[model samples]
Target: MGLLAGCWSAAATAQALDAPNVVVIGPNLVTSGQPTAQALARLSQQGFEAVIYLAPSSVPDAVGTEPEVVAQQGLEFIHLPVPFGSPTEGHFESFAAALQRLKGRKVLVHCQVNMRASTMVFLYRVIFEKESPASAWESVTRVWSPEGPWKRLALSQMVKHGIKFDPF
Candidate 1:
């Protein structure tokens, strides 16, 4: 009976970890794809205190009224608007600053498909949180492998921050 109970507990934990469009990166942070209003409500129910959006409002899939929806759900909303074609260091800095300020708070950082969110979170974890580069890269790659300009941006930023990781 004890062994059966342990299996049940593990299954339950796996289910919680498999929330659609959401990835639990650490104790205080979660990354996600574009979330719907229902998803935001669910996040609130799950105790996420803040939501940081990296995608711009002009994006076709973005929820234009997300700020109001997030406010209604009682979650703080921040928009940094990093372009998919060309993410800048300034954008990274803003994201880092916001993440730093929100340290210890339950925060969700999201982009259109978790690409930007995961990369930004990877950099934050490696540089600011002093996490291992390989470990942080694992989380980032789990979403989407960065490429082209995005790849360049990530690599350059990592170099600037003195983070070293072998290309996977």
Candidate 2:
């Protein structure tokens, strides 16, 4: 039964790696929801080279010790600490800069439940990667359909980047 259990565990890992909320934006880029310490260790074991955390440590669900854990696991950790309702262009810029610097490394970008990560990744793809807005939007919507301030933040960044979106 150990073999069977191992198979089931592998299958579960694969499924989690393929979950819609774990958005693989590129060969080297992934965006996911907040992950526990165990999940961080697993990600390191699975060859993720770096983690960019967009959620503040003060966030209700944040694991405050994640940075230290990630470092102990030998994965680079970058913390940007975006607020839930008010993500700024500077935040996006920093994230984009980190991504550019880490190009070719397998990196995970995560925020609380992926809301912030997905939106930022969408903007990054459309603005910097030259991906079509429609395609980027598809990826964003797959994880979550942003509304209210989140939607406004996305739209504002799109405009700043000169990527037009129809409001209909």
Among the numbered candidates, top TM-score falls to 1
lDDT of 2: 0.79
lDDT of 2 by residue, 3-105 (tens): 7775665455445553236766655677888876668767776778999999898887787888888899888999998988887888889989998888889
- Model 1 alpha-carbon miss at residue 18, Å: 9.7
TM-scores for every candidate against the unseen true structure? 0.86, 0.84
Off by over 4 Å in 1: 1-21
Query: What C-alpha lDDT, on a 0 to 100 scale, does residue 91 get in candidate 1?
Result: 94
Q: RMSD of model 2, in Å? A: 5.7
Q: List the residue pairs that clash in candidate 1.
A: none
| Candidate 1, residue 99: how far the Cα is off, in Å | 0.5
What shift in Å separates residue 152 of candidate 1 from its native position after superposition? Answer: 1.1
